[model samples]
Target: MSAESDYVTLISSDGYSFVVQRSSACISAAIRRMLDPSLGFAESKTNTCRFENINGLVLEKVCEYFYYNEKHKNSKDVPDMDVPAELCLELLMAADYLNV
Candidate 1:
Protein backbone atom coordinates (compact mmCIF):
# COMPACT_ATOMS: atom_id res chain seq x y z
CA MET A 1 0.00 0.00 0.00
CA SER A 2 1.07 3.63 -0.42
CA ALA A 3 2.35 5.74 2.43
CA GLU A 4 -0.34 6.99 4.81
CA SER A 5 -0.04 10.80 4.49
CA ASP A 6 0.31 10.21 0.79
CA TYR A 7 -3.45 9.79 0.90
CA VAL A 8 -6.39 11.87 2.06
CA THR A 9 -10.01 11.20 2.92
CA LEU A 10 -12.99 11.84 0.70
CA ILE A 11 -16.46 11.83 2.18
CA SER A 12 -19.39 11.15 -0.07
CA SER A 13 -22.76 12.90 -0.01
CA ASP A 14 -24.33 10.17 2.09
CA GLY A 15 -21.43 10.41 4.50
CA TYR A 16 -19.56 7.43 3.09
CA SER A 17 -15.80 7.75 3.27
CA PHE A 18 -13.01 6.68 0.92
CA VAL A 19 -9.25 7.23 0.97
CA VAL A 20 -7.55 8.86 -1.98
CA GLN A 21 -3.91 9.66 -2.61
CA ARG A 22 -2.88 13.21 -1.80
CA SER A 23 -1.18 13.33 -5.18
CA SER A 24 -4.41 12.30 -6.85
CA ALA A 25 -6.34 14.83 -4.80
CA CYS A 26 -3.97 17.43 -6.16
CA ILE A 27 -5.60 16.73 -9.50
CA SER A 28 -8.12 19.37 -8.48
CA ALA A 29 -6.51 22.56 -9.70
CA ALA A 30 -8.70 24.66 -7.46
CA ILE A 31 -7.76 22.90 -4.24
CA ARG A 32 -5.38 24.73 -1.97
CA ARG A 33 -3.65 23.52 1.13
CA MET A 34 -5.41 24.45 4.31
CA LEU A 35 -4.45 28.05 4.91
CA ASP A 36 -4.34 27.80 8.65
CA PRO A 37 -0.75 27.91 9.90
CA SER A 38 -1.40 26.29 13.25
CA LEU A 39 -2.80 22.85 13.78
CA GLY A 40 -6.07 22.84 15.65
CA PHE A 41 -7.20 19.72 17.49
CA ALA A 42 -10.24 19.39 15.26
CA GLU A 43 -8.28 19.50 12.01
CA SER A 44 -5.89 16.75 12.96
CA LYS A 45 -8.43 14.09 13.82
CA THR A 46 -10.92 14.93 11.08
CA ASN A 47 -8.61 14.75 8.11
CA THR A 48 -11.46 13.08 6.29
CA CYS A 49 -12.54 15.25 3.34
CA ARG A 50 -16.00 16.64 2.96
CA PHE A 51 -17.43 17.00 -0.52
CA GLU A 52 -20.80 18.72 -0.39
CA ASN A 53 -21.62 18.81 -4.07
CA ILE A 54 -21.44 15.13 -5.04
CA ASN A 55 -24.15 12.62 -4.21
CA GLY A 56 -23.59 9.08 -2.92
CA LEU A 57 -24.02 7.20 -6.17
CA VAL A 58 -21.57 9.39 -8.00
CA LEU A 59 -19.08 9.15 -5.21
CA GLU A 60 -19.25 5.38 -5.29
CA LYS A 61 -18.22 5.49 -8.91
CA VAL A 62 -15.41 7.89 -8.24
CA CYS A 63 -14.13 5.51 -5.64
CA GLU A 64 -14.22 2.86 -8.31
CA TYR A 65 -11.98 4.99 -10.45
CA PHE A 66 -9.56 5.44 -7.63
CA TYR A 67 -9.40 1.70 -7.13
CA TYR A 68 -9.00 1.15 -10.83
CA ASN A 69 -6.08 3.51 -10.95
CA GLU A 70 -4.56 1.72 -8.04
CA LYS A 71 -4.69 -1.53 -9.97
CA HIS A 72 -3.13 0.12 -12.98
CA LYS A 73 -0.55 1.87 -10.86
CA ASN A 74 2.24 0.82 -13.17
CA SER A 75 0.55 0.82 -16.53
CA LYS A 76 -0.39 3.75 -18.73
CA ASP A 77 -3.74 2.27 -19.55
CA VAL A 78 -6.27 4.44 -21.36
CA PRO A 79 -9.52 5.30 -19.60
CA ASP A 80 -12.06 2.61 -20.32
CA MET A 81 -14.98 3.78 -22.42
CA ASP A 82 -17.47 1.60 -20.62
CA VAL A 83 -18.51 4.10 -17.96
CA PRO A 84 -22.23 4.68 -17.66
CA ALA A 85 -23.64 8.03 -18.76
CA GLU A 86 -24.72 9.24 -15.34
CA LEU A 87 -21.48 8.08 -13.78
CA CYS A 88 -19.46 9.77 -16.50
CA LEU A 89 -21.05 13.07 -15.67
CA GLU A 90 -20.65 12.59 -11.96
CA LEU A 91 -17.03 11.54 -12.33
CA LEU A 92 -16.39 14.57 -14.49
CA MET A 93 -17.92 16.85 -11.90
CA ALA A 94 -15.98 15.19 -9.12
CA ALA A 95 -12.78 15.38 -11.13
CA ASP A 96 -13.42 19.01 -11.94
CA TYR A 97 -13.99 19.80 -8.28
CA LEU A 98 -10.85 17.89 -7.31
CA ASN A 99 -9.13 19.43 -10.34
CA VAL A 100 -7.98 16.00 -11.60
Candidate 2:
Protein backbone atom coordinates (compact mmCIF):
# COMPACT_ATOMS: atom_id res chain seq x y z
CA MET A 1 0.00 0.00 0.00
CA SER A 2 1.12 3.56 -0.73
CA ALA A 3 2.06 5.80 2.18
CA GLU A 4 -0.08 8.68 0.88
CA SER A 5 -3.29 7.50 2.56
CA ASP A 6 -5.26 9.18 -0.21
CA TYR A 7 -8.05 6.65 -0.13
CA VAL A 8 -9.97 4.62 2.41
CA THR A 9 -11.72 1.28 2.24
CA LEU A 10 -15.05 1.12 3.99
CA ILE A 11 -15.90 -2.43 4.87
CA SER A 12 -19.45 -3.51 5.42
CA SER A 13 -20.56 -6.34 7.65
CA ASP A 14 -21.14 -8.67 4.71
CA GLY A 15 -17.54 -8.12 3.50
CA TYR A 16 -18.44 -5.62 0.82
CA SER A 17 -15.83 -2.86 0.52
CA PHE A 18 -16.00 0.56 -1.03
CA VAL A 19 -12.83 2.44 -1.86
CA VAL A 20 -13.25 6.19 -1.86
CA GLN A 21 -11.06 9.24 -1.86
CA ARG A 22 -10.00 10.44 1.56
CA SER A 23 -10.98 14.00 0.79
CA SER A 24 -14.52 13.11 -0.22
CA ALA A 25 -14.97 10.62 2.57
CA CYS A 26 -13.99 13.25 5.09
CA ILE A 27 -17.33 14.93 4.53
CA SER A 28 -18.44 13.07 7.63
CA ALA A 29 -16.91 14.35 10.83
CA ALA A 30 -16.81 10.87 12.29
CA ILE A 31 -14.96 9.56 9.28
CA ARG A 32 -12.72 12.62 9.23
CA ARG A 33 -11.57 11.91 12.75
CA MET A 34 -10.99 8.29 11.91
CA LEU A 35 -8.68 9.30 9.09
CA ASP A 36 -7.00 12.09 10.95
CA PRO A 37 -3.30 11.27 11.14
CA SER A 38 -2.87 13.29 14.28
CA LEU A 39 -5.33 11.08 16.10
CA GLY A 40 -3.02 8.10 15.75
CA PHE A 41 -5.96 5.71 15.81
CA ALA A 42 -5.82 2.31 14.17
CA GLU A 43 -8.11 3.47 11.39
CA SER A 44 -5.84 6.43 10.68
CA LYS A 45 -2.91 4.09 10.27
CA THR A 46 -4.69 1.68 7.96
CA ASN A 47 -7.01 4.16 6.28
CA THR A 48 -9.93 1.83 6.69
CA CYS A 49 -13.04 1.50 8.86
CA ARG A 50 -15.11 -1.60 9.42
CA PHE A 51 -18.77 -1.42 10.25
CA GLU A 52 -19.66 -4.94 11.27
CA ASN A 53 -23.22 -3.80 11.94
CA ILE A 54 -23.90 -2.24 8.55
CA ASN A 55 -24.90 -4.17 5.48
CA GLY A 56 -23.52 -3.47 2.01
CA LEU A 57 -26.68 -1.98 0.54
CA VAL A 58 -27.06 0.78 3.08
CA LEU A 59 -23.37 1.50 3.09
CA GLU A 60 -23.43 1.89 -0.69
CA LYS A 61 -26.07 4.59 -0.50
CA VAL A 62 -24.19 6.43 2.25
CA CYS A 63 -21.03 6.42 0.20
CA GLU A 64 -22.98 7.87 -2.73
CA TYR A 65 -24.32 10.60 -0.47
CA PHE A 66 -20.79 11.46 0.62
CA TYR A 67 -19.77 12.13 -2.96
CA TYR A 68 -22.98 14.01 -3.63
CA ASN A 69 -22.41 16.22 -0.65
CA GLU A 70 -18.85 16.84 -1.70
CA LYS A 71 -19.93 17.95 -5.16
CA HIS A 72 -22.49 20.32 -3.69
CA LYS A 73 -20.52 21.45 -0.66
CA ASN A 74 -20.12 25.00 -1.81
CA SER A 75 -23.21 25.44 -3.94
CA LYS A 76 -25.92 27.83 -2.81
CA ASP A 77 -28.78 26.21 -4.69
CA VAL A 78 -27.83 22.59 -4.61
CA PRO A 79 -30.45 20.26 -5.95
CA ASP A 80 -32.12 17.83 -3.64
CA MET A 81 -30.55 14.42 -3.48
CA ASP A 82 -33.01 11.58 -3.39
CA VAL A 83 -32.94 8.26 -1.60
CA PRO A 84 -35.07 5.23 -2.33
CA ALA A 85 -38.16 4.96 -0.15
CA GLU A 86 -37.36 1.42 0.88
CA LEU A 87 -33.92 2.49 2.06
CA CYS A 88 -35.07 5.33 4.27
CA LEU A 89 -34.70 3.56 7.59
CA GLU A 90 -31.46 1.79 6.78
CA LEU A 91 -30.11 4.98 5.26
CA LEU A 92 -30.91 6.87 8.42
CA MET A 93 -29.17 4.26 10.51
CA ALA A 94 -26.10 4.28 8.31
CA ALA A 95 -26.05 8.06 8.34
CA ASP A 96 -25.99 7.98 12.12
CA TYR A 97 -23.14 5.54 12.09
CA LEU A 98 -21.22 7.73 9.68
CA ASN A 99 -22.38 10.93 11.43
CA VAL A 100 -23.45 12.26 8.03
Candidate 3:
Protein backbone atom coordinates (compact mmCIF):
# COMPACT_ATOMS: atom_id res chain seq x y z
CA MET A 1 0.00 0.00 0.00
CA SER A 2 1.09 3.57 -0.57
CA ALA A 3 2.23 5.62 2.42
CA GLU A 4 -0.97 7.68 2.37
CA SER A 5 -3.16 4.61 2.37
CA ASP A 6 -1.34 3.37 5.47
CA TYR A 7 -3.45 5.82 7.46
CA VAL A 8 -7.16 6.50 7.78
CA THR A 9 -9.14 9.56 8.75
CA LEU A 10 -11.94 9.25 11.27
CA ILE A 11 -14.41 12.12 11.40
CA SER A 12 -16.60 12.73 14.40
CA SER A 13 -20.22 13.76 14.50
CA ASP A 14 -19.39 17.34 15.34
CA GLY A 15 -16.96 17.73 12.44
CA TYR A 16 -13.68 16.88 14.14
CA SER A 17 -11.22 14.84 12.15
CA PHE A 18 -8.55 12.46 13.43
CA VAL A 19 -5.93 10.81 11.29
CA VAL A 20 -4.63 7.53 12.66
CA GLN A 21 -2.58 4.59 11.46
CA ARG A 22 -4.75 2.15 9.52
CA SER A 23 -3.31 -0.89 11.31
CA SER A 24 -3.97 0.65 14.67
CA ALA A 25 -7.52 1.65 13.80
CA CYS A 26 -8.30 -1.79 12.41
CA ILE A 27 -8.18 -3.19 15.91
CA SER A 28 -11.90 -2.47 15.91
CA ALA A 29 -13.87 -4.97 13.87
CA ALA A 30 -16.39 -2.40 12.64
CA ILE A 31 -13.60 -0.21 11.42
CA ARG A 32 -11.87 -3.14 9.77
CA ARG A 33 -15.01 -3.90 7.79
CA MET A 34 -15.60 -0.28 6.86
CA LEU A 35 -12.12 0.10 5.46
CA ASP A 36 -11.89 -3.21 3.68
CA PRO A 37 -11.10 -2.45 0.03
CA SER A 38 -12.92 -5.44 -1.39
CA LEU A 39 -16.09 -4.32 0.33
CA GLY A 40 -16.15 -1.29 -2.00
CA PHE A 41 -17.59 0.94 0.71
CA ALA A 42 -17.27 4.70 0.33
CA GLU A 43 -15.07 4.78 3.38
CA SER A 44 -12.71 2.26 1.80
CA LYS A 45 -12.29 4.41 -1.27
CA THR A 46 -11.58 7.60 0.65
CA ASN A 47 -9.94 6.02 3.70
CA THR A 48 -12.22 8.14 5.83
CA CYS A 49 -14.93 7.10 8.27
CA ARG A 50 -17.61 9.29 9.77
CA PHE A 51 -19.47 8.28 12.93
CA GLU A 52 -22.87 9.86 13.08
CA ASN A 53 -23.67 9.16 16.69
CA ILE A 54 -20.21 9.56 18.17
CA ASN A 55 -19.14 13.01 19.13
CA GLY A 56 -15.61 14.37 18.85
CA LEU A 57 -14.63 13.84 22.47
CA VAL A 58 -15.83 10.27 22.55
CA LEU A 59 -14.34 9.49 19.17
CA GLU A 60 -11.00 10.86 20.32
CA LYS A 61 -10.96 8.43 23.21
CA VAL A 62 -12.01 5.65 20.89
CA CYS A 63 -9.06 6.37 18.65
CA GLU A 64 -6.78 6.39 21.67
CA TYR A 65 -8.13 3.00 22.72
CA PHE A 66 -7.47 1.67 19.24
CA TYR A 67 -3.80 2.56 19.50
CA TYR A 68 -3.64 1.21 23.02
CA ASN A 69 -5.17 -2.07 21.98
CA GLU A 70 -2.76 -2.39 19.09
CA LYS A 71 0.21 -1.64 21.32
CA HIS A 72 -0.75 -4.22 23.94
CA LYS A 73 -2.06 -6.92 21.67
CA ASN A 74 0.60 -9.46 22.62
CA SER A 75 1.55 -8.29 26.10
CA LYS A 76 0.10 -9.81 29.27
CA ASP A 77 0.69 -6.89 31.60
CA VAL A 78 -0.76 -3.67 30.27
CA PRO A 79 -1.38 -0.34 31.91
CA ASP A 80 -4.93 0.84 32.39
CA MET A 81 -6.12 3.58 30.09
CA ASP A 82 -7.23 6.74 31.84
CA VAL A 83 -10.84 7.61 31.24
CA PRO A 84 -12.70 10.56 32.59
CA ALA A 85 -15.69 9.65 34.74
CA GLU A 86 -18.15 11.85 32.89
CA LEU A 87 -17.48 10.16 29.59
CA CYS A 88 -17.78 6.57 30.80
CA LEU A 89 -21.31 5.98 29.56
CA GLU A 90 -20.77 7.60 26.21
CA LEU A 91 -17.53 5.72 25.72
CA LEU A 92 -19.20 2.45 26.58
CA MET A 93 -21.94 3.07 24.03
CA ALA A 94 -19.44 3.99 21.36
CA ALA A 95 -17.32 0.93 22.14
CA ASP A 96 -20.36 -1.28 21.75
CA TYR A 97 -21.32 0.31 18.46
CA LEU A 98 -17.79 0.10 17.14
CA ASN A 99 -17.38 -3.46 18.45
CA VAL A 100 -13.94 -2.60 19.68
Using TM-score as the measure, the top candidate is 3
Residues 2-76 of candidate 3: C-alpha lDDT, one tens digit per residue: 323988999999999999999999988999999998887889988999999999999999989988888899999
Ranking by TM-score: 3, 2, 1
On a 0 to 100 scale, what is the lDDT of residue 88 in model 1?
A: 77
Report the lDDT of model 2 for residue 72.
95
| Best-fitting candidate, scored by lDDT | 3
C-alpha lDDT of all candidate models, in order: 0.61, 0.87, 0.92
- Residue range 1-100, candidate 1, lDDT tens digits: 2223666677777898777766655444433343111433232345556778987777767666666666666878667735788577778878777665
TM-score to native of every candidate shown: 0.60, 0.89, 0.92
lDDT (Cα) of model 2: 0.87
Stretches of candidate 2 exceeding 4 Å from the true structure? 1-4
Query: What TM-score quantifies how close candidate 3 is to the native fold?
Result: 0.92
As for lDDT, the candidate ahead, 1 or 3, is 3
Worst 10 residues of 3 by lDDT: 1-10
lDDT of 2 by residue, 1-94 (tens): 4435778999999999999988899988888988787887788878888988889998898889889988998999999888899989988888
Evaluate candidate 1 by giving its C-alpha RMSD to the native, one decimal.
5.0
